[model samples]
Target chain A: MKSEVNTVNNNISSLAQAKPLASPAVQIDFLNSDDLIKFETKLESSALYPLVSSDIDIFQVNLGKMCNQVCKHCHVDAGPDRKEIMTKETMQLCLDALDSCNISTVDLTGGAPEMNPNFRWFIEELSQRGKHIIVRCNLTIILANNKYHDLPDFFAKHKVEVVSSLPHFSAKRTDSQRGKGVFEKSIEALQMLNAIGYGKADSELRLNLVYNPSGAFLPDDQKGLENEFKRRLKNNFDIDFNELFAITNLPISRFLEYLVDTEKYEDYMQELIDAYNPEAAKGVMCRNTISIGWDGFLYDCDFNQMLDLKVNTASQHIRDFNAEDLHSREIIVNQHCFGCTAGSGSSCGGTTT
Target chain B: MDNSYYDPKDLKKFGNITEWQPKLGEKFFDYYGEVFKEGALTAREKSLIALAVSHAVHCPYCIDAYTSDSLKKGADEEQMMEAIHVAAAIKSGAVLVHGVQMMNKADDITM
Candidate 1:
């Protein structure tokens, strides 16, 4: 009877908090539900439900680390500050790896991968081979250069799966992480992509949003957050996308700096360790997705690539790219593994679960 | 917005969580060491859960670490394998338990 009274009180308080009656656009803040089940209920019903995915087979190429913005959590130290760019010969090495590996997909990434002069040429080659092409875009880069002006239509034409970053739906949060005015430019770039049918729900040209956490903490539940993101973004910015990928920020480079600066190094480490749900150990991205750096060196994943932790095999570079060699190759990992095991695991592709 | 407490994206400043909090960092280091020992749930098992938790609680650091850990622990095969099955079971179970609320709602309607 006492419990029942408590439940009644909760219901009454909730009712009182329910829609201000003045605002129809929102019933309540989407993820404020103390009830996890309510959140999941919304997730299963979301339009951007992570399509059960296995890696699209392919040797992905890290074109370069020449980005336009300096995101706080970037493990690559990628920014206008980074000068490393992929060479044409290195690009050719990628093609060679693709040919040797018979990879069906060819993922292209970088600081602002579009900044690579050969970016278009490489995509054109991949498209010619009828490979599923994936391009990681910073989004703002599209507007940063005239040469990139038609990236949306170009991506659509080639049917490239464009995974672009938009850290948060709100301008304030986004700008804080990615630099001033970047949010506006990202939105514009997204609109351009949408106009070309890149992110339309049913369109073949896929445009997915990439989310990195602004601070040291892990991202929220992807399904619930994605639903809220879809709703808020669709309603607020007139933007449309197929999915929102919640990627983890690895502890390396600038982020490592953040850890030290914030003195969150220990707690964050403990969080991952304490939250080390053994379940995440099985399906991490690096297990299936092999990362190739700009110079054709093979690493288990992009973070490994940055740490210069090349795959432990006789054949390291793309020129020596071999599926048989990689078949049982031990992926190199260290203390950072806690990050992935700590939460719903994160990876280059996004959240593991 | 980025700390352990609360992040009101609804509010502009997620609050100034001073640049450093040494205590949490120390705590993390100690637990991290404990979690990594052999048979301490093995980093591999933790990886799969970390991935799922990445989706659950949403920490990017945990996600990155586990993704790498899972792969390193001879988890090179497609994650769609048995390990993924485990995560699927847990994640689905987690979501489904909340269905009790929906059932309660239905029960309320009936009564």
Candidate 2:
């Protein structure tokens, strides 16, 4: 026999002759093929969980969908070019919801939200009503144009809790998920908010930064990632804030388009289904928060609002807001729900945990 | 597609990424690394949190990374499955809770 070298060489040659099993890009179809039936079953059966809820009062103010940027993951399909802006009538209805219901917290969201012509006015009205207001701002929007140049002062003035999207502290990754130049402006805007004492530990201004992944991945750890975001922004760009919220991007609108375009749909969905955490399930945001569509239609969250899944209640639009009637109403759900409960749970605010 | 982001077509010019800014890419790389490491929380803990958040934000890349991460870091199949269920609960709950507004709207209509 020859030597051990000859034997090893023969084995290596045979190994090279074999075909590859699958590439990482689309491995699900190749290896996880057997999961198709179970995947479909789970997808259809998301709401069978034990954590259903029916008590909530706040009427989240979805003022409009016209945002300054068309983020790749935006569910509302809102952007600067959008002509559909919230009307004064819708604003009034939101205020009415605050006044009529025992709703104490009013979550205000929109495209850039600050880009809304009546955004400040709406905040003023809600503040006047002594409601806990949360304005979801795309940080970059605060500094992108002169019209919104004064947003920091405006938010702080109303004592509004600002939930701004940062995605990442680094520019390239952030810009990759958002558009070009967005990361820099976001950092700058965050700095402005920090200067105004929004995210500071003891500050009451309450500037919470939101982070979604740059690609089709889960957001990294929230507390640690927040510390890092705080450290980096503080070191690199001199920005500061209170908390760093790590949010999972909902698979709808532009993000759904991205998944289909990049061919990451099935694997990603399977990953979510495979990684469902029961602890995460208990903290799901939909149970506590209400999302209103731009047109006053109701949705469980912004993602469903984008998919046009209005509440399945007798009153679906803003023209009919009654806290008690909704207290016992059953929520309508579909496959997209798996996206929410798949992991730690996601919401407009961030991780439910 | 013609944006300034790292397009794969431009993978060959990895050296040129820093031409625009000398240390930005590597800096991002470092921060990116630090973010994914074990924390006061273990890697397993971090992975589970990431997995849960992936559903909340709904990033497929995140779902892919955290699924593998959780499994590798000792998350059993059931544990992982349970995490997604948590997300489902919150998501559906979020959708259903808004029914309050609808109920209020309906109450105003009927009552």
Candidate 3:
């Protein structure tokens, strides 16, 4: 009964309009491949067989995939529509492991960690246990909803170390990587955090910003980029942060799709492979960190966690936590490990050397 | 053995310029290296300038090299695009400004 000519336009929400940007171009097995393994062998000493862990000092927990913004380069493919979340039971199990496993830092991450319903409860428990809590916050989340408006105050109260991702100090670059209006919200959120003494001199309320390259390349000198970010942010927005962490974009999920879409997958992979630094490889974060997914599965690193490459061990869940076994287990690796080992190396904490 | 004027493989043999005139080629490379080093302008700024000039000169090899170099030097997409626009505007203006010569010639020859 409608007219042939259109009148008022009906459109879907951005979230509804969202679909994955990257898809596998060819049928290729990223894992169990001979090329990456051969490359690793050439880079390693005679003792390199199964890449093993040293000790689990940093326990990173992915709360869920629910996020306010769907970034083009997200490895997790996490968005608002993702209903996966860690249950309180799993959180309790993780807390129990932390108590026994001598874990020093509890690194909490997610599509947006704050979006988790039990985020506060888990943080409170970790804080009470005297664990150094690092919340991998996406700054826009602080300004996403009215309830989240008080996040800065809450973070300050808990003395949580907030590591937020700000792809660039410039609005144009940041918005292109994230979404429209995201850069403004992130700036507002940063200002709020600064007002609460989060990034102040002689303040324990530490606030660090994260930077990842916005394209198919490795990040430049971390210290130089950090200085540029600090100078620009101070001059333009009157903002300050403890430090900037420049992360390399891993070749997985949306980024992999981007590589395939642009026909640069092999070239980019070759670049990473060619730039492999043995010194950087020795300090890869997987040696000391263990990542736990929302559904209780474990991984050597977050990238492995996203790729469903669970920790290479029998006891691969928090419920089956065996400190000795988990600590001694070999790390699960693929070609993507090159991302972390290239140049000065990358991890949740930024450059290795 | 191909008869094509522009061989795709010629781009790969860019380093072989020294084969013909080693001394001059080496000097040109050394001067080129010195010019691109960080000075009053940061490496990033120099890279953007090079990218713009590459577009103006319309050199495919230079364009490709400078595009990657500019990105590695921390130039984002918007900055790169803006640099290209700068090149485009200058190129367009250069051609238009030369049109004044045509106008003068036409007036002087007219009866």
Candidate 4:
């Protein structure tokens, strides 16, 4: 039950409340440093300058910013102390929007989406709509409290695709990026998920694990990492998972703070820029995913939502849902966008390529 | 130019060696690439081997490159460390085994 202090809780003057960091302007300024090439310029070279949406097929909803763990590289800066959450009213607005659109997949993220009081209710609503639901579970939350202990069962009941972050299978690596004892709890949570139909060879219940690098490096090949994760987890713990999503940690929020503090910002950004793949760029997730904030604000993607960069369309909120406007509007690109386009490219689902 | 002998940035320019010597550079790169492909040893195993050899040769660039490579290939920290330890043992053993030569020389001189 040991709770790691967050940037807000630590009262580190620069990172206090994470509000200044949350300001899109401030983050944009940081991204626009003199040395780095503009992400837009790179996209332009690849004939992707005005990155537009193909289809708004996925709705990545940030349910809240409250979580039991404070992961070092969390772009959301979500933690237990944060109170911002999507009210049932907002959930209803989202539901109304979903009804109006053809968006078939609903991806729920947060400090832990389950921390939202109306989480189950919102899922129940989405379930009834027959929308494919993906919950970005932190895994530790399932073991964090008594109320959350049955989360696996609840997820299985809804046939929710459970995507949990387990940065590394080893305790030291996982605990370092996440929190101490996080790996142990996550293993227990995975085992629980396995005991049910989730991750079984014969089961439809999809249980995917996410592996972002523990540091500033880009993620390796998805298939290779997945094979390794599968072999190690199966042999070591007898655990089963459907897939491993090798995500690259975007430079923003807490991860931005880390890169700057370690004097690795320029190097990491350069690394991202150098490793930029045009093929990967074409498949960037922002083109297909519209991220909705807790308060109903919309953005191009989850990283954009954290930076407070709303989508360019006039339909800026769930209540003002306009599929046509959203689809036509040019997606926002910043230096942080390099993260998603680097190497294999990263998305909430996994590598785009 | 940087005063130091090594610059991490140079690693990215490694492919550019072909600009000066295209044939040899291309051949070397092709050979290197083909050597690391999945063979009797998994690509993951090759990456670990490369990491250990990177350490043994004390090449900072290779060490940096292969450490990230090994991790990307899903080689965990323990396995990586163990590979390095194997390199360390061989390196030390190479030096220690030469002590037998010293013993032989001393015996010849003294006798």
Best model per DockQ: 4
Question: Using Cα atoms with residue i matched to residue i, what is each candidate's TM-score against the true structure?
Answer: 0.65, 0.68, 0.83, 0.92
Q: Model 3: C-alpha RMSD to truth? A: 5.9
Name the best candidate (by lDDT).
4
Q: List the residue pairs that clash in candidate 4.
A: none
RMSD of each: 19.9, 23.8, 5.9, 3.3
Q: Which of the predicted structures, 1 or 3, would earn the higher TM-score when compared with the native?
A: 3
Candidate fnat values, all: 0.00, 0.00, 0.35, 0.50
Lowest lDDT sum, 10 consecutive residues, model 1 chain A, at: A22-31
3 versus 4: better TM-score goes to: 4
| Ordering by lDDT | 4, 3, 2, 1
Model 3 Cα lDDT, one tens digit per residue, B1-94: 6786556557757879989999999999899999988789877888899999999987888887888787766676788999999999999999
Q: Which portions of model 4 miss their true places by more than 4 Å? A: A1-22, B1-20, B96-111
- Per residue, candidate 2 scores C-alpha lDDT tens digits across B4-89 of 54344353354567678878988976776798777677676678878998988877657766776774443545667788889899
- What TM-score does chain A of model 2 get? 0.85
lDDT of 4 by residue, A273-336 (tens): 9999999899988888889999999999988888888898866988998787787679987889
For DockQ, candidate 2 versus 4, the one ahead is 4
Candidate 1: deviation at residue B82, Å? 45
A56 Cα displacement, candidate 1 (Å): 8.9
Residue-level lDDT tens digits of model 4 in B1-111: 779999998998899999999999999999999999888988989999999999999999999999888877778889999999999999999999999999999999995
